[model samples]
Target: MEVFALVGPLYRRVQRKIELDTARQGLSVGLRAVLDLLREHGPMTVPQMGRAQSISRQFVQRMVNDGAANGLVEAVPNPAHARSSLIRLTDAGRAAIEAAVAREHALLREAAGDLTTADVDTCVRVLGRMLRLFEDVDVNGQAVS
Candidate 1:
């Protein structure tokens, strides 16, 4: 119970760090995910990207639209869709994500400097379990993980 009590605040603090890092990089978390997904998987439709990232398709669509407007991504004709489009990272988008990832990694290493590799791995595993639990209960509950 005491550990549970500490978890919320600690999670929020970590979330805040991510929010701050995203803001400092001038990218929202959603946009960053889109860019990262594109960088890793080549090109994909917004729906495909959303599925890969576990974000809502509508939300992913909006991010792609925003990125398109900002010159980070462009709409390419998707023959399979005929209406919607596929998104691919521009050179600028790839560069932006690379920079943001480098900074985020540096921040994470600095913040977790006291922890051993095993400790970090354990933390990640715990968080993954928690997320899966939340997902399993999402339909019966009202919360975001």
Candidate 2:
């Protein structure tokens, strides 16, 4: 229970840091997440992104729309889905996200100065198990599984 309590505060602190860091580059938290997803997985549908993030499809759609307007992302025709297009990152998006991530990585490295790889690994394992314990629930507190 204490670990769960710590997780929420730590997450909020990191989220705040991310908002500050990304805002300088004219990106919101959602936009950064969209770019990161495209960078890691290449082109994907909006529905797929929503599923991966466990967020609303409408929310992801709004983020994609914003990214498209800013020329960070463009939608290409999907061969499998006639209705849904696959979203991919533009060169500008790639550059922006990469730079942001690199900056964040530097901050994380500084924060990790005292923590060992094994310590981090064990922490990750614990956190992952905790996440799985609630994986069946939707973001809205509805049962998903």
Off by over 4 Å in 2: none
1-145 in candidate 1: lDDT tens per residue? 5656888898788777877888787888788888889988988998888767666899999998888887899888997888877889998898988898888788777777678989979978987887676774434365644
Model 1 worst lDDT run, 10 consecutive residues: 136-145
How much is 25 displaced in model 2, in angstroms?
Answer: 0.6
Candidate 2 overall Cα lDDT vs. reference?
0.95
lDDT of 2 by residue, 18-114 (tens): 9999998899999999999999999999999999998889999999999999999999999999999999999999999999999999998988878
Best by lDDT: 2
Question: On a 0 to 1 TM-score scale, where does candidate 1 land against the true structure?
Answer: 0.73
Would you list the clashing residue pairs of candidate 1? none
Name the runs in model 1 displaced over 4 angstroms.
1-7, 139-145
